[model samples]
Target: PRVTAFSKQLEKFHVIIDSELAVKMLRDAPSPGKNWSAFLKVDCGNNRAGVWWKDEAGVDLAVLLQNSPNIDFAGVYVHCGNSYHTSSSEEVIQVLDDTIERLMTFVNHVRQRGVTCSTVGIGSTPTCRKPTDRMKSLTELHPGNYAFLDVQQWSLGSCTEEDIACCVATRVIGHYPRRNQMLIDCGFTGLTKQGYGEMASGYGVIRGHPNLKLCKMTQEIGFVESLEGKLDYSLFPVNSLLYILPWHSCATAAMHSVYYVVEGDTVVEEWRPTRGW
Candidate 1:
């Protein structure tokens, strides 16, 4: 239904297909005389969405798409999202190597069946950030998260803390000396509740203050306390700004419509990203 509704606009875009049903959908989509371009999404190891790379059905689907008159079989697309679960950079490379080998084998199988895949690609911020020589064999790489890296990417060794480009700025709203906790203006609604128990600093990392931890958050307020000693209210006065490095920048960025691009201490530009699908 989506393809039929956006047929005119989708002619300029390449869609992903993982099954014969999707191919049929595109073939019958209400766009006459339009040979829709599409990539066969192959599941190397992510197991999220895509036909398994080793499955014979995948090869058959590739051939079917290649032979179809109403569709243009562009290539194979793989999302190596498993790389994000690794403990270290070496493990990330291991997953990358395994995914590449499996994808290449699948591509070879399709080639043997007389289907020429021009663009064999794999993508994830972890693998793409640390490129290997084996990646040269592929034609394209799409690492969307690298643009605004988060604490998760840093944990995966994909980038350093300095490489993180975006953060949520909140202000100190209240102080509680008895409980050794302070409140911030941002909460799950503003910063999201994604990284609970993931980082040592709790929901998000408080920038430039290693001693501080964002222990909890409500709909519109965040509870912050010192990780070690007692909380010092003098250090964080009311109305003072506290920047938080989100564990997932994509989720945090979705909460706001306008992004204030800052250089040093100056607010240089404001970018209003396009919303909705």
Candidate 2:
């Protein structure tokens, strides 16, 4: 419906097909605008979606989609999401290279069969960031998390702390001097329940306070714990403001409707984001 609503301005939109049935459905579906194409999603290694790379069915589906007159074959795309599972940059690059090699071989096979495959889209933040050189065959890189680097991205060596852009600003609501812990107004509702990769003890790090971490939380309250047990409790009194770097910026940002865009300490603008499907 949204596509039809804006059909006047939409020149082309490509839908990803994971199976032969999806390709058939896309081919049969009425065009929403002037040009609509289909992208065959091949699972190079991710195992998340798309037809498996070694599976002959995938090639058959691609050939079918390419020959279909109603839907143009926009080529194949693979999202190597498992790239984040690697422990180091070398491993990430290896996964990306392997994925790309498989994708290239598949495209080559399709071309050998007299099919005109043009675009080969590949992306995953860790894979894209770690690759020493770009794959010449890949037409597009669609790394989503690169825009707002999260703790996971930093842990995966995909980005650094300086590259992180989003954070949660919370105020101290309660203090536990005896346990060296304090309660902040931010919780799962605001900061989200996501945790940093391999850093099991805390959910997120407090900006500028390397030893302080948001360890636990309820619906509306976050427990700030001092990692070293040497934190001066006097500094964080009631109503004191603190900024929390989110473990996963995408999930955390989804909790808010409008972004409070700030420049230095002043609110410069308000940006509202799209919501719902």
Candidate 3:
């Protein structure tokens, strides 16, 4: 909708374009009567998208975006999405700080081009936890999803375990004679696997069972493995419901068509479904 609003105003006030194709579209755009700002995207350390910041001509794309009569150069932006793929907060901080330093240098180079700049921006959840003032000099910090954090964010120091707001509820289908094992009805079908490989075991975390872990899963079968020693049969029994915390709640929740809202022991309502972009 922001893009659409800017498009409608393409003929009136100033605006900024975030994508390269957007830069080009606005660049070759017919006379809009007003100038629009478009920044080049550069990948400093993140290999995902955007121009390589290390490239000598990285900021040169900004120059191209400026070449158009209707398009003004806003500055470059990059996102360290790759930073979320780490285990420790210390490691996440290292990548975020390094990327910011590299991006600032690139922004400076754009200024050296003698073009009047408007803004510069970049983002990530782990990066958001770092002091924003250091990058406030940037045009904007557009980090989304911090509001709906998950286990990955918790482990990365972006948030605490208490910050995760989504979870899964499954019932113990069959108790294993092997002590700790259980055949849960939930499997890849219920909770899609999206955990970072950093975890010691399975794709999901068991909520209250500190010693019990989701060992593995099949189409509709789950193997509960004991954290240590042998599994005792006294604690959990067949038909006992378990709330499984996801490694990444958003991704796992996306698998289910609907979410049942359970209060205490009874589900009173169901949440609506969501669509992907």
For model 1, name the residue pairs that clash: none
Q: For candidate 2, which ten residues in a row score worst on lDDT?
A: 1-10
Candidate 3 stretches greater than 4 Å from native: 1-39, 69-75, 85-90, 114-117, 178-180, 229-234, 258-276
Residue 225 CA error for candidate 1 (Å)?
0.5
| Candidate 3: residue pairs that collide | none
Poorest stretch of ten by lDDT in candidate 3 = 10-19
lDDT of 1 by residue, 111-144 (tens): 9999989999988989998888899879999887
The residue pairs found clashing in candidate 2 are: none
Residue 221's lDDT within candidate 3 is 73
Residue 218 in model 2: lDDT: 90
Cα lDDT for residue 27, candidate 2: 62
- Local error of candidate 3 at 207, Å? 0.6
Candidate 2, residue 163: the lDDT equals 82
- Enumerate clash totals for all models, in the order shown: 0, 0, 0
Q: Write down the TM-score for model 2.
A: 0.91
Q: Order the numbered candidates by lDDT, best leading.
A: 1, 2, 3
Error of 2 at 131 (Å): 2.9
Cand. 1 Cα-lDDT: 0.90
lDDT per residue as tens, model 3, 1-277:
3544556665545444435577677766665455664656779877877877777666666766767666666666788887877777778777777888888887788778866666677778788776544665677776766756777777777887766767778888887775657777788777776773646547677787777778787776777877787777666778888777788776777778887776666889988775755
